[model samples]
Target: MFVTNVERREERKGPPAGGRALDLLGKMERNEREYDETIAYALALASAWSYADPQALHDVMNSLGFENRCYAVTLSNDAVSARTSASLLQHVDGSAAILCFRGTEPASTGARLADTGVEPARLHAWKAVQGGVHSGREPMARYIACRLKRAMNGQSIVDEKGELVSVDAPACSDATGEPLEHRLKALYITGHGLGGALAALAAAMIFEDKEHEGIRDVVRGVYTYGQPRIGNEIFARRCQDTYGRLLFRHIHANDLVPMFPPPSIGTFEQFGHELRSSAAGWVFSEQPARRADTAPFGSTVDVLAWVKQRLPLVRRLQRPFSSDEHAPHRYVSVSQRSLRLRRSELGLSLGRLRG
Candidate 1:
């Protein structure tokens, strides 16, 4: 069934209408018996994409809710296929699987993060620490909980009773008095834009803490996509000083979200480390759509221009950081076949079986 322009207009009225549609969509998607039905419904909704209201799109997403909706399918013969719901499309598949949601809003992004039990306050603190402050002694856990509770007020993501209806975090580990590895992995720290900086801070804390030696090496690589605001130079430097190398930062050329420059106080080069920047190709105009198999490395001129337009301070900051010159490495363009091969090497399959 085709969604008419009138239906699209009706959906755009307010959150309530959007919520209703989304709830219906999510319910359908979650039922395995109704997978085809839901897919049909989603396709119908997607058709309305041309004239649909952005708010309505968000509401529909809220309705679907988050459920490990996407996965890397492993076949009986050990072949892997990357499968995602109709709504979302794959962006980049390589050493890490990077997927983006289509037509998402700040509210939905926040809800997604909250659902993972990562509240705004914790993120703020994470951002603060990533800017080079030590938050170990701070009452971070309590503060985060309190701030999050306050933020949930008057929001649809929460119920009338002020209880969250969608988000749930895994229980913190009792044995180690820390968050579980899988829990941390599941936490979409990068959803709300500041996730990269927060993750950087979290990584710094782990490296600095002598007691966390068990997981020190585990925090080595940081993969961030569409990280809106730039992180603090001091924080990046702290990571470099401790880890002896800066984290790998990947960006999609068209992703305007992460292109925004860091504040003057937290310039990218201030941390005295070299950022290994790589560029990938994005499929859609907006973020979180299906990506191509191979990503191209931005040319030197292109990369410099990107920094100047998006991160002006980086150009100035790059000079001093060159003092501790590491051997320059050539940027490798990623190919689709390479990505598939890489996944195979990791004991996963990346192709779908034809019916």
Candidate 2:
């Protein structure tokens, strides 16, 4: 059975050429403290970007004093009904460029009603790529890479009066008319939940696209919160090889998305130092977590277990309740100002990232 649009690829696989995905963790950048300046800054930006409105998003960024007037934003244009948000924002002072992605909207509850088979969801799972077991393309990653650039030029269906956005769209004259990828500099990418998953894929996309070497390695860094697994082990290995110490994946306790979509079967794996959330804040480490049945298949027992997991009673039994942990607000409750309204407080309402 298909867990969602992204399913376990029972056929093709990514070649097992790359090293263990966990090995890449050793090479990831370390955050000495969870609430340090860097993380605080990143989480704040992530919260701001989650919003569909630029003036509002920028206001959050502006309050934090990050100058980014020109931005390129895009939401998913796929038929899967996956609502995605990817944007490139340049710092007003040009210190570092920020690409912020939005996670599943809080209003998207798993049990929420939808038309026919269309359940309210945020991510679009991809089929197996040309590679082997550990090698497969992440669909959302590919979508973001293709659309984010033109999106900067207001090439989006949302077309929510791009002119009304505080950030200006991309212009050919800006990067000396060079390809958008070549002009990216001091780039920092961050996302939450599926947004985090896409940001992870988005980061790897640039690094793998050596043709766009300008953006291939020029990224200042990458940070994600409660992100789901996007690709196979080979993909994780590739992310490690490409981003290396530049990547950091942060997970909160009981955040199911990060535990998701199965690895052995789905072939998806997470790479980078695992920053586990703690009562004090976040704790970083280079470790492989227990394999979760993100997309349980094969036996009827497994399917039954998956069904049992969704019951409200089961959720009540868990700590950090998936709902609270998945939201961007919980990730940045340390910063009170950033924890307000729909931008930061959305997750507290209701949401889901599918199974």
Query: C-alpha displacement of 262 in model 1, angstroms?
Result: 4.8
Index of the highest-lDDT prediction: 2
lDDT, model 1: 0.28
Instruction: Report lDDT (Cα) of residue 337, candidate 2.
Output: 25
After superposition, which runs of candidate 1 have C-alpha atoms over 4 Å from their true positions?
A: 1-192, 228-231, 244-246, 261-338, 341-355
For candidate 2, write residues 243-334 as lDDT tens digits.
Answer: 75666677656555566554444556678767766654556666755445433221233334345467766644534224344555556542
Please, what is the whole-model Cα lDDT of each candidate in the order they appear? 0.28, 0.47
Clashes of each: 9, 15
Quantify how close model 1 is to the true structure by its C-alpha RMSD in Å. Answer: 17.8
Q: lDDT (0-100) at residue 96 of candidate 2?
A: 46
User: How far in Å is the alpha carbon of 134 misplaced in model 1?
Assistant: 10
Looking at model 1, the pairs that clash are 22-60, 22-63, 23-63, 26-64, 80-349, 90-291, 100-288, 115-167, 237-271
Which TM-score value belongs to model 1?
A: 0.32
